[model samples]
Target: MDWSQVNWQPQIGDPHFMGWVTVLVYLGCAILAFKLSLNATHCFKQHIQKQRTFWGVVAFITLLLAINKQLDLQSLLTEIARTLAKEQDWYDKRRKLQRIFVIAVAFTGSTTALLLALYYRKIIMINALALLGICFVIAFVVIRAASFHHMDHLLNQYIAGVRLNWAFELIGLALISANAIRRLNKNTRHRASVD
Candidate 1:
């Protein structure tokens, strides 16, 4: 059944809403992380001076990427549906875009990780979590695209792979959160001691 046929007034639960939920989750994580990271800008600037170019670029790009996702994902998703909603080759275009986005995210995320690992010294945990977050973001993008193409009532291998990858990424994010809290407490203790 075409989505148009669904009753709009009463609002039936479209399992397809899960795709939207996943996107929301990705955006939420980005926003929360971005805000927390932004709050540390002064510290990053002062402490990260030795690797200024790399760290500066990473911070800038991370902020830009998060803002872009907040603004761009919805419009892009609509554009995608309009262009490839009924096409048989929809998966091809999606695959191409997914690969491109994955590479971009991986590069940006890895660069951020490198900067923290090199400059911040104490954020080994944050860097590790950010890497995992990048992996999850890639999976999130791929899985959404897969759901879009799954309209043909067909089973695709990549969709399954993405779901499996997403599961592992959850574990990574949990570790990152734990480590971040630990690091925050440690920093707090050191600051108090100095005072």
Candidate 2:
């Protein structure tokens, strides 16, 4: 068990290259989300308040996620947990705190998604609900792997380009991007026709 040999930051494919590539992709998605928010507010006149609020929230969330990915917030939390456990002289408390944090985040995210879905029964909102579902599934898989001491194998598979979580996250981003672009284009065409 040579800890030095363990790749702490195992990413999909080439570790060095893929990490930057994924970060860039996430940044692009965040930019797209911001653009969509702007278009929704300025270009679309109908349902102005609702459209702006929805897109604005989406943009904020996307940007936050992009930043979180870039910063590796989970690792930071892990470090914090380790420090706390060391100070308290409790070995297992780190894992307990980490689990609590994960559960809290998942619960908050799901509740937010459910509220949004109920408020807006549009296709995009439905897609958001689906994205939330995928997130829950991914979390469940990761928790199961960790509980069974199979996380190393799962992470190895992820590094080998079988990253289900990343795939689902990208899919969710794509769905939001597509929906925004479609609405923007439709509004633009309608405006042109009316002019």
Candidate 3:
């Protein structure tokens, strides 16, 4: 396979289109998170401190991820890898080892998060988010494995353009936004009834 013939640039489909869409979704979710934070502060005064902190973190993280996706951080990492490979003959081996390490860490972290979510199953949103996190981890693993094995065709086909992984990410962000809105509406109704 001619590596030079490969389209390294983002194209009109899977990944690029999906990536931009994901960015938009993340932005909306970030907005929802901020709104949730405000509602927590103004309406849910009983749990004001905890709710505000949680929603604030959600907003921050979602906004950061939106920026990261827009920037295409994975491509940047790939460029860094290519540059390091040019400098050192051992870079390829080191890169493979690094990939293995990342996979291990992702597996461990996702498992721990899932377990914690199970323990806090009363929080429906946490369970949903944890499941989404697991899906992201699985997608990451598939992409990494494809890259390591020189399965560029598979990566490009399933993971790159209108990428399944990016779709999962967008779905997760949308879920967060939807859940936040639902909770806010519920709280608002409760407060109105009490008043």
Model 2 CA RMSD to the hidden true structure, in angstroms: 6.1
Query: What are the lDDT figures for the candidates, one per model?
Result: 0.46, 0.56, 0.60
Query: lDDT tens string, model 3, 61-176?
Result: 77877776665555545655655565666665875766786677678767866674565344535326524543453455445432554444444456444655555555666567
Q: Which stretches of candidate 2 lie over 4 Å from their true place?
A: 1-15, 41-46, 93-99, 121-152, 158-162
Put down candidate 2 lDDT per residue, 1-195, tens digits, no spaces.
234433345333334655566556656656765665566543435556566667676666666665656565545445454555566688566567556766776787678667776765544442364345335434543353234234535544564565755554566566666666666676678767878
TM-score, model 2 to reference: 0.67
**Any runs in candidate 3 off by more than 4 Å, and if so which?**
1-18, 41-47, 111-155, 158-165
Rank all candidate structures by their lDDT, best first, as comma-separated numbers. Answer: 3, 2, 1
Q: Please report the TM-score between candidate 1 and the true structure.
A: 0.42
- Give the alpha carbon lDDT tens digit for every residue of 1-195 in model 1: 245532233222223544344434444444444444533332344553333333233344344434544344434554455455344446546657655765776687568656656665654343455545554544454444344454323422346455443344344444434434443454567567868
The root-mean-square deviation over C-alpha atoms between each candidate and the true structure, in angstroms, is: 8.2, 6.1, 6.2
Which model is ahead, 1 or 3, in terms of TM-score?
3
Pairs that collide in candidate 3 are 13-161, 14-161, 14-162, 14-163, 15-161, 15-162
- Which regions of candidate 1 deviate over 4 angstroms? 1-45, 48-126, 146-169
